[model samples]
Structures are given as structure tokens and as C-alpha cells.
Target: MKNISRSTALFERAKQFIPGGVNSPVRAFKAVGGNPLFIKKAKGAYLYDEDGNEYVDLINSWGPMILGHAYPAVEEAVREALSCSPSFGAPTAREVEMAELICSMIPSVEKVRMVNSGTEATMSAIRVARGFTGRDKIIKMEGCYHGHGDSFLISAGSGALTFGYPDSPGVTKGTALDTLTVPFNDLNAVELLVEKNAGQIAALILEPVVGNMGCVPPAEGYLEGLRKICSKSGIVLIFDEVMTGFRLSQGGAQQLYNVKPDLTTLGKIIGGGLPVGAYGGKREIMDSVSPAGPIYQAGTLSGNPMAMAAGLAMLKHLKDNPGIYDALNGTANFIIQGLQKQISKYRLSCSINHVGSMFTLFFTDKKVIDFASAKTSDTVLFGKYFQAMLSRGVYLAPSQYEALFLSAAIDKTIADRIIQASNESLEEITK
Candidate 1:
């Protein structure tokens, strides 16, 4: 077995200080039955753990390292920005440039606001929607995570789902009352909610292509149907594209699916793997934010120069080479196809939900189109598969509810290796 002694030691040391031995709940590997591997460094498509073991990274920093870790352009940009100073706590030319680039690329965003993380972006977006519409209630899809904001904890996904506390305790009963939820891809449910809530609902937010619930794509015409519903009901349509933005397409899932949302929250690739996020939409709606309107939201490090520089470099590269999307999707398809062959060969009860470069190998025969269906997965078997894959140098997301992201750095040879690892891992786990 690959030595994970160092990781074990680190976890032991960390638990005395950090909560649950990791900064993030999912990183504790509680669901997968092991201590987490502390990453030493990452480059291209591989992660080197503290144990001196190498892994073909399938998580890609949870969907940020699209061009792969430590990419030359992103690194160069950050280095140059670092020399100037890390933070000014004031606006800079880079932030303006970043905003212009985002507005230009994303079809719905005529104006934008930068934040430190996806949670901040989503929280701010919802507030802005409420202010603009003069309404109190909002609708979120079940299992579609919009960060750790108090209003979004009900029926949430991602780490919340993995920990078996979708409705987090800290969230007030009042917050829960305002947040309405329905299963994803169910248009009729959404319509019914809209009718019942009527003018009280301010926004309808969702992940146009959900990465939280293992990469579930929208049902055919689902986006269009929601768009129609929101427009008719005078409810703000917010697409929490924090995971799908830039990764799925130049304009994100909205552009890919040919539907536009009033507000879009973005993170991950836009920050070039750094901790940054943004929310934006139509000019009138964005004008409702502070300094222009009344709704207040501020952050000292909202547009840190380093983040802006790194994001600008990453976004510019993507804009210039649009073919990267095609390459990433192609690689993902190859890997998924190989895994499917293994499932067939072993007669494994597994199903995969894929969109663009994000996917999940669910340990279930049932199609995973919604949270309830996703839960039908055999978590115990997934834990075994995860351990098996880790042993074979293929690092997957520790939680069964999480999706695996592919990067441009993974070539055909690496893809073949991952497939081979999956085949061996499956055999070993089943035995």
C-alpha cells in the first residue's frame, strides 16, 4: 500500500487546532472513511501529496485548474502583481479590466461586482435580487448548492450533503421560511411554487448545470422554462454558475444552453485557481447595489490586485483559445467512456452523469438527475472505490455527492493511465 503515514500524522496534529482536522468539512474524508491527503504541490494534471506520492488529479481544485495547476500565464501574472503589492484595499485598473472582460464574455452580465469567494458572491447576488424586486422569498433547487449563506442551507448539496446536514442548524427558522426548494429539473414543481408564492418571491436561483449534486445537467428546455417563469412572475432569475462559469463554455452554461439569467455568480476558473468570485447581471438590476442604489455589500479584498491579475490572465487565455473547451470535453468523454467499459465488464451497478468536463461515477444503476436519485447511490461502495482509486494514484473527489473535474493538462497517455487505474480499482474493490 502507498504510504499515507505523513497524512495520518498531519490529520492527528490538525484536529487539535482546526475543526474536524481540516478547513473544509469534505476535506476531512469523513464520508470516505480515511484521513485526507495533504497536498504538497500541484502542477500540470498531477498532485504531489505530503507522503511523497503522486496522484493524477481528477478534482482539479474542485473545478478551478482548467488549464491545470501552476499554469505559466497565471503564475506570471500573479508574480508581477505581487511585486506591486498584494492588496491596496482600493480599486485598481486591473479590477476595471476584469469587469469589462467578464461583461463582454457573459451574455447576462452588463455590470459586475467582485468578491472574495463563491459564497460571498451568491449571498450578495440574492440580496441584490431582493432589493431590486422588493420581495422577500426566493426559490432554490434541492441539492443545488449556492454556498454556505444562511438562506441557502436548506436542502443544500456539496459538503452539506456529504455531512448529512443539508438543513444546517445555524440557519434561522426565518431564513428557512424564505427559502423554498423543489427537486431539480422539475419544471412543473417550480411553476407551482411560483404560483403559490406569487409576488412574495424575489428570485429563483440555481446552478444552470449542477456540479454540487455530481454534475447533473439541466433537463431539456428546463432553463428556458425557468426563464419564462421568472420573467412572467417578475422574479429575478439567478444562475449560480460559480462552478459552471468559464469551465463549461466562454459564456458558461447559459450560453451553452442558449438561456440567459438576470444575475450570474462566478468563481473557480475566473480567479485562476485563487479565492475570488463575482456576481453580475443587467445594468438596472446591478444598479441596485450600494454606492449606486441601497442594498449594501462590501469587502476589503473584493478585488485584490493579485486575484484580478491572475483572473485576467486566465480569462484572456480562455477567450483567445476557445478550442480549450472542446479539448477538455473530449478528454472527459474519453475517460468516462473507458470507465463505462469497465462497468460493463464487471457488471457494476454504476451510472455516470456528465456535462462538459465535470462528471461523477455514481455507485448506482439509477439515473442521477436529481438529489433524491443521487442519494440512491451506494455510499459504502463509493468509499471502497475511492480508496481503491487513491491506492492506484488516481485521486477522485472523496465524497460520492461531488463531481470530478478534468483539466486541459491531462493528455491521452494520462487518460489511459486513469482508465487503467479505474479498471484495476474496480476489480480490487469488487473482490
Candidate 2:
């Protein structure tokens, strides 16, 4: 159970080269108070750490592994693509194939342009929005993570929001001025922002379901209200479905909520565990980018062959098998219900929020509606629970602000194990 020795050794080596011994900030374990586990390999529902400790993984690479780690078809597709080539700055047939599949599957996406990460996808989308509408200001939802770009880095989520510093160091005050942020699921704040900005606002982008604040869904009529307001004022509505896109459903949160966005940003599952991102929606809006239009955005690895092939394989499999969602939802419900039962029985002062395959257990009694409410959760209590769960061979997102993703690879047995671990962990931590 002790991985401290291997993790410490790796951390020492990594800190010398990699900043904070991790590429991503959340992996630093500052909030959880332990060395982050160095995952050697993952398969199906389990992750094997450097010290050979296996655990039921709930993070699922932050919502990408719907079919679980190293899915056979996706892995095979990537391997086959590797035989040909990895990247080509020019066009590839696989990119077209991938785009076609994505557009067909995602209801709102008519013309998807590939990018290297969610940051690029969102950044490009915002640029396109400004170019198409001829406006400078954009509005984003508080506690909603779009990406790491300068514009999105303002009032961001995940690491930035978790640490209570939405405005990052390098992001200038001018960049922050162009981006206005309001609370999640707050339609009034959105309405006021739109009315106040009027013609100056180019677009309003948000996670349809606030995943960064631990899976807080939009209130009833919230998205519909935004849609109406945006349409009325000539403001573009962008759905930052980078986390919920393929994970929520084949058509993503847009289809799930029955709200079509002007622009949509997608990542994670599309890459089939590789690094890839895409932004697409109305052809008119997308046509404003690159050679076809004025705004230019390019990447050497934008449509990498391997990423395309893996994504194609993953999307094709999901499209072919419609039952994947049902299975994933059922598994997620099982875990959430189990955790709720334990919470009720033990009378724990916590709240659980779930949507499809994503869920979070917050250490608070208030309804986690927005960033303000989500902040009420006791971080010290969450840290205790996180450590206990880790000790019980269960892997969770290190930060309480992050969502726990469940994949289809997690069977009944794995779900049961997680539930049992939660019950035990709660008891141990609360005691």
C-alpha cells in the first residue's frame, strides 16, 4: 500500500526537469497532501502505479476513457496509424474521416477543425466568434473550465479555480477585461451581462454542465434562456463541451440538453486517450476561420494521423454500439446511489452531484449551484476523504473541485468496490 518510496524518487527526478514534478498542476498533490501516484499502466477499470499498486480508477483521464484504458479497437487503430505516420502539417485523409464522423455524431458540429488541445480549440473558437460578429468582449461562466488560453485562463476552473486564483499570473489585465465571467447556472447574471454589454459582446461560452465545479448541471431553462438571449442580441453561444462532449452522449451535452450552440469545443474522448481537440458548429461561424475566412489558426499536429485514427475508431465504435451510454450511465448511477446511501446512513455532512458518467461528493450541506456555493465545501474534510479512499485502493481526482469520471469498462464489481471503499473511507475519515 506504500507507494511513497517510488513516488518520492520519481518526484525528485521530475522536479529537476518538470515544473512542480508534473505537467498538470492538479497532479502536484498540494491539496491532497501526498506524492501523486506515478501510473505505470492502465487497463479496463484499473490503474497500476509505479509501485505496482492497482486501484479502481474514477478519474478516467479527466473524462476521456469512456471505454476505459487502452481500449482494444482504439489501441489497434492507433498502432495501425503509427505504421504510416504520426503527423503531417498538410492535410490527411484520416483527418477528413475523423471530421466527418464527428460532425455526423455531434448534432451541432457541421464543420469541425482539429486542434492539439482544448486550449487551442477554445481559443480558435473565440477568435472566430470575434471575427464573424465583429465584437471584442466575451462572457464565460464562473467555475467552468474552457482551457488554458489567455482568454479562458480568466475566471477558469480546475487548477485555477481550485486554488482560488482564476486570474493567472501571465494573463494580462487587458486580456481579463475582454472576458467577463458570471456564476454557473445563474441566468440572471448572464441576462444582466448581456444587457450591459449589448453590441460589444461577441460570444458567451460555458460548459453546458459545469464539470469543474464537480458536475453541477445547468438549472432548468438556464441554457434555453441563454440561447434566446444570445439570439436576440446577436451574440454567439459557445458550448465548451471539452469534458462532456463524447462522455455525456454521442451528440454531447448539447444534444442531451436539446440546446444547439453556435460554436462547440470538444476534446478528451475524441482523441481516444491521445492529445487532440476540435471546435465546430454552424458552417457559417466555422467558415470564418483560416483559409476560408480571415481569422487564422494553425497547428503542425492539429490533425495528427494517429490521433485521427484513434478518434475515428472510438467514435465509430460508439456510433455503432448505442448501448455504451446506457451501460455507462447505469454504472455511474450505481456509484452515486451507493455513496448517497452511505452518506444518509452515516449522516455525513456532504452533498453528491451527478450527471451521466460524472459525479462528485462535496463536503458541504448546501446545494452546489455555482462557484460561490461550491466554495462552501470543507476542503480539509475532502482531503481526509481523499487520503482514505487512496489507502483503500481507489483513485479519485485529487481536488474536490474536480469531477470523478466513470467509464464503461467499470463493471458491477468495480462499482461495488468503489462503493465499499467510499463507505469505509467515510467512516475512517469522519472518525
- How many pairs collide in each candidate, listed in order? 0, 0
lDDT of each: 0.94, 0.89
lDDT of 1 by residue, 238-313 (tens): 9999999999999999999999999999999888988999999999999989999999999999999999999999
Estimated TM-score for each candidate = 0.99, 0.98
Tens digit of per-residue lDDT, candidate 2, span 167-238: 889998898999999988888888898888879999999999888878898899999999999999999999
Deviation in angstroms for 282 in model 1? 0.5
> Candidate 2: TM-score?
0.98
Q: Which candidate is the best by lDDT?
A: 1
**Clashing pairs in model 1, backbone N/Cα/C closer than 3 A:** none
Task: Name model 2 segments beyond 4 Å from true.
Answer: none
lDDT (Cα) of model 2: 0.89
Runs of candidate 1 with Cα error greater than 4 angstroms are none
Question: How many residue pairs in model 1 have overlapping backbones?
Answer: 0
